[model samples]
Target chain A: MGSTATAKIVALPMVDKHADPEPVETKASAAQMSAAEIQVPEPEPIPTVSLTKVFLGLLGYVTRERMITALLACISIGALFLFWYLGTKYRLEFYIRFKNVPTPYEVYQQLTQVGLSNKYLFNIAMSVRRILLGFMIATIIGVPLGLAIGKYERVRDFFMPVVEIMRPIPAIAWVPMSIMLWPNNEASIVFITFIGAFFPILLNTIHGVHSLDGVLVRAARCLGASEIRLFMNVILPGSLPHIFTGLAVGMGVAWVSLIAAEMISGQFGVGYFTWEAYSLVDYPAIVLGMITIGVLGLACSGIIRMVGVLLMPWLAFAPGGRR
Target chain B: MSMTMTEAETHKGFIDVRDMGVTFGANDNKVVAVDNVSLNVQPGEFVSLIGPSGCGKSTLLSIVAGFVKPTRGEALLDGKAITKPGSDRGVVFQQYSLFPWLSVRKNVEFGLKMAGVEQSKRNTTARALLDLAGLLSFENHYPDQLSGGMKQRIGIVRALATSPQVLLMDEPFGALDTQTRVVMQEILTNIWQQFRISVLFITHDIEESIFLSDRIYVMTARPGRIKAVIKVPLPRPRTAEMTDTPEFMNLVQELKGLIREESLAAMAPEIKDRGLSGFGMKVGPKGVGEIF
Candidate 1:
């Protein structure tokens, strides 16, 4: 057997690299008689590293990562500060026309006042409760439907057309229908919120379930997992990242639609407070409402993110952490 | 010595697959993956199915594992026809089939839990398997935290956790680097010897089959059929040194010849035609005749 010729090139001598200018038979046939004698040169020794070198290398990596984050944060904060100072200093027409452009300090005061007022907290709590209720209901309906649609072609075919037709219509558009369909005004608002959040959650869940590795399912089957066990053990856990994705998206949609729903429903909520302030042209209160919505949206999304981190800590360190 | 031909003969196969054919789609749209393939794996025997990528080796393994049913013919375990997947057979996939969400211990425990092995026994079984795979310390770590070899080891442990009668492996170490793959082969050989589990391993690598299998079944492509089944007369408890022997080399060469022909056959039609799609061979005159 011509082993040398067929063998992959494994090595070269160090001095041979610098000095040699020779041709040799490296063919497998030439080495057949003494296959054991055929040898590849040893690889160069790795450079030794001291403890200081190792420690410094790790330090450099950490510092570089943190520095980039710090730089981006500084730039964004600086930009925001500049915009606030300039908008108030020159009194921009947009800010002036609304007369609701509270200075940074005034906005802070309003934030504190909203935080302190029991009634304010109550309204905020009510809005959050409504959002939660609607979100919870949508999740219950949407996740199972999404999973079914994802798993079964027949189920998908039956439900997809109806879902597609309903998916595009704005959640606000459902307000009147919901009011008519349900007896209570609160139910109508909740329905609108559900409509707002349902599609993204359902769509993402379907995608997640559909995108699961078929081999994993096969693995589960061979392991003697019953149908329900397979879903719980393999399918559900596999699609969880997508479910979290849907929840985050659904939460965002819920916030956007909840404010709109409250505004339209003429309810005792933050949206109503904002509308009332607008009717009276109370500028600070309007500023308060916008900031409240912004902060609340941030807090809700943050909560969703925190939940995601807690559930799938491994995912946070995955190739690229999107959140 | 107790070793005798009659003993070998009396060692009845654990699974019998006779003239099994798996064809996808229907009638005019039909495509055959495995065609009239018959195989028998005896108790504690290590058998490998080797061929080109499209030679239905995987399909055949899947049929044995009960992941897919043969369109025609029967696959039986201990004389009874197999229909659906069961805990009796465990499969390790090529793609390090460890569940990313679960820790190493948990992944192994999955099959045990399915078998309804109580929590106490499950932990013990999981730990033993993990220890056998040399991954006892990584029990608490998720699949992502492990290297390719470690993940594959976990996969093996997971498959064996149910204490299945047969272990079906589909190129389980195909994704690992060359060095890691060699190490894993050794690890697998050790595990197989320890468990004495009947195995139906599949691979495209010629040398891999020679290194690990007791007998190898070479397959033809497309509407795949078994071309040859050659018994490897190498002595058992094979070591790394055994792979360098003249006998092993000769076996590797023989297997390569079979695989090389199928590989060329598998691609012959594709190279012959400029426009080709799945299973649809466009007959054209720019054809290169059989390489063999």
Candidate 2:
């Protein structure tokens, strides 16, 4: 394309010079001269940037709102640390002393101690594995069942009552039943986590499928798509945004149930670590476990969001999207 | 080209609506949406259906597109009944129904892909059509990235991508602004000139109907049936300047009168029930009725 433009520029004056005779000589030569000048000069290399200017340029990109947000976050975190310090230093009240709340510095020291210990890493890995396994099981079962119920009224009618009845029962409440049903503590804990994750994913998937644009389905039909093709191409992709919402919510719930189940039944997990700390009166270790759970939950939800953005570039390009 | 000649002789591209009627609800609650409507489009002819709102213009278009079945009669394509939607009859809806999930080029290639056209071939064909519609540069963009006009253009090209025998458009440009609609009309005209596919376009706009169609089928207000089949005496390769001519204005005026009369007739029952003194008072001096 670039070569064609150069060829056109070179050819235009030659044609003008040949077609008209009077004052074309200087004009044609001038055009040729400019074209030659353009061809002769190479593009300049990118200039090297000084360190201070580069730093300032990077700093300039951070808007005032972002700066304010960062400042507010820092102030809030600082306030939390100050409150913790004062509360622990003074032994504030009965509940605070009974709970044995640790100072931020004590918790930080405990975190470093735990980080150095192999048991702490093992507990984290075990907890993460349990959550992932339970979440995957829930997704595999929920997505297909949800799609069926959403797409067909008869299927929905058959399953909706059963789902509604079972959904409200808390994962902790299922601990006794899961223990009786399953052969081992591992299976029971996983079952509890799966129960926690399943409802959210299923409900969200149903909502996603229900909210699919009727025009999209009709348009697919008009395009000569068969039933299977319509489901695969239109229905599945169209409901993706809602499905991602479900997955993210489900991941949070799965972790919640996994920890609860671990506290009651587990031998080696983060929840077990926290429960043991409570029994041993290690307040700082308990705080370390709580912080670990919070950080892990955030990371897991962030990963789910990233996956959603990857699957739906259209959503990424939409107004107010992360992209 | 010779195949089209043979098909023309055999009425291949022809769309025949034989006493087609559609009713909704049951017994006492029944509403006659389209009443014994009959119309036809000849091979390679552009026909527009114009009527007031609630007059089942879209219902009629839907019948031809095979989305809705006629309660009584049937719509035929090349003497065969249209029971379900197929690639044989391509439809362009009032809402630009381009798939939001798909890119512009992929949306155009959808029907072709459904027909099991090889990937490379469909891609080439889609690219050519997009290029013709001046949307080639936006091939990678999703439908959400496009303006209303650009999306409608993509809708048109998507419908045409399959090379369907008859193109059924339901007020394809109704949602666009006046300037965009005019440009779209010209683009549609150019496309029609090249393909010469039989079209049954539905629109309430009198001037638009007169501008694009070879013949216009005017329907009654409710329980829509053919009231008039006005033939446009205008020449093809129609430009925007043609709409300013005496002939175009005369046709517009004539259509306005027909529509106004039907619209009034449709509202007569309501007017009588309300005991409004003047029957024709609601109609403005410009011949535009507010019934719609």
Candidate 3:
């Protein structure tokens, strides 16, 4: 048991890329050094926590507890596959139709055939680029505007109404107006994507600022922080965790907007490919395009999560991290 | 006002509140949190405000800290009106108010950094202060990683890093367990003795007030007014053994009596309004057994 524990400690996972290495090493040595001094008749080796590696962390910082969570995630996805296989094989048509839908193997066949094609690859690249560009622009404009709206009462009064009135309107509803407003299809689609991502980021940021602890501001002021210094030191850091939440939610919305714009007016994008396949009666191809979209959407959100982890190093090993 | 007090002779942390009152809302909804009250803290003196829960002890402290404006009069620090919060007065709150994002060392260094101190200087100052608090080893840890007592200790150390003239504390140990609170009281007195900075503390604990303060101000409940001003005659570098002495116990009984009177008065209006002032009324299904 002792040897296994030592090996486990030796293979400890990293919490963050910038996690300080000194404590982890010292704790490890301390635990090992204490082994020879005590000979109590305990059933198991008493846990000596190496704080850096033993607790939960983000991305590549997988501990044994997180591994079980990962395993459960895999099982959930596997269940979905099992349902899909059964549905296609039995031609189930309980409420929704799956009578003529292709099996998972058939979809895989379609993926191998056209997935490597220039058109498919090109469409995937276009959709990803559009979403990323739109998201970057949205974040740049939304975060500061949100911060301003959150900080000053007058700014909130002016902007919050416009945001509130426009927020509930679907991005797809703006597609026609966006097309007329911009010079080209790319600009129009990007605009629609921006509209999709912007409001959540703005609203979340406002809420974040509004919810900031008043006592913290008092504490900061009493500590001699000037107005600018208070904003930089307290206000900015306090709202960052919320901003990232906004970013992740924005990324998801941006994808939905991207697909709508691409399906309606795009020359090339995964959304266009999926819609075109439907028009051409290529069932398997449509499924394959959808799968591509799902994979890419997951990838986009995963990247946002990792960035959130990177920015909030304090939250890296915390269980809930942030709300 | 004394004629002989020179500008240099008047040291830092000399607080003066003259007829200060703070009222919230107005007209029909008007609530007077603090009434016309006057008090002063001598430079380097340890003072405490003790009262019932709603007696505006915290409001008085907040006025001194420059967080709340006085509706009637003024609060002065070292002979100047406190127009706004400044580094000259540091505050420690009851909530253990350290930024969770910062490491313990960084939390301590926050005030110094705000004052434009260099990184190396911040480090050394923070380290020295953390050592003084007996938390030098835990400097690298975050606030969330520390226990309640540790967080409050860091809060004290952080407040002192700027070399502030006065420390304004509002029941800082109110949330801690009894054991931790006693230990913290000792730790705080030690820090106070070391720096000799003036402290204006607020607490509901009578013993805490008597134990820590050179002078104690007892206040009445809502629209709070100063009820009494008492001096603690305990010698310097006070020990736990001092608490058991007849003098200390006598002070405790005195403070408790003062506070109990105000607490009963605080409840009287509400009881009258609710029409539950008399014991003749039936309560809880008309039987004591049913209530129990």
How do the predictions measure up, each by TM-score?
0.84, 0.85, 0.86
lDDT of each: 0.77, 0.82, 0.82
Candidate 1's displacement at residue A21, Å, is 38
Docking quality tier of model 1: incorrect
Candidates sorted on DockQ, descending? 3, 1, 2
Residue range A189-294, candidate 3, lDDT tens digits: 9999999999889888887888888888899999999989988898878898889899999999999999989999887999999999999999999899899999
TM-score of chain B of each: 0.88, 0.90, 0.91
Kindly report which residue pairs in candidate 1 clash with one another.
A2-A28, A2-A29, A4-A28, A5-A27, A5-A28
> Considering summed lDDT, which 10 consecutive residues are worst modelled in model 2 chain B?
B1-10
lDDT of 3 by residue, B1-292 (tens): 0111244433777999999988999899999989999999999899999888888889888889988888999999989999888888989999988987788999999999999999998998897776566566678987777667778888998998888888899999998877667657766875676577789999999889888999999999898999999999999766556898999999999988998889978988777666572634435556656645
Candidate 1, B121-170: lDDT as tens digits: 88877876665554565688777766776678788878877767788999
Candidate 1 DockQ score? 0.20
Candidate 1 vs 3: which has more TM-score: 3
Per-residue lDDT tens digits for candidate 1, residues A152-241, read 899999999999999989888887888889999888888988998899999999999989989889888988999889888888888889
TM-score of chain A of each: 0.76, 0.77, 0.79
Error of 1 at A66 (Å): 4.9
Report the C-alpha displacement of residue B290, candidate 3, in angstroms: 17
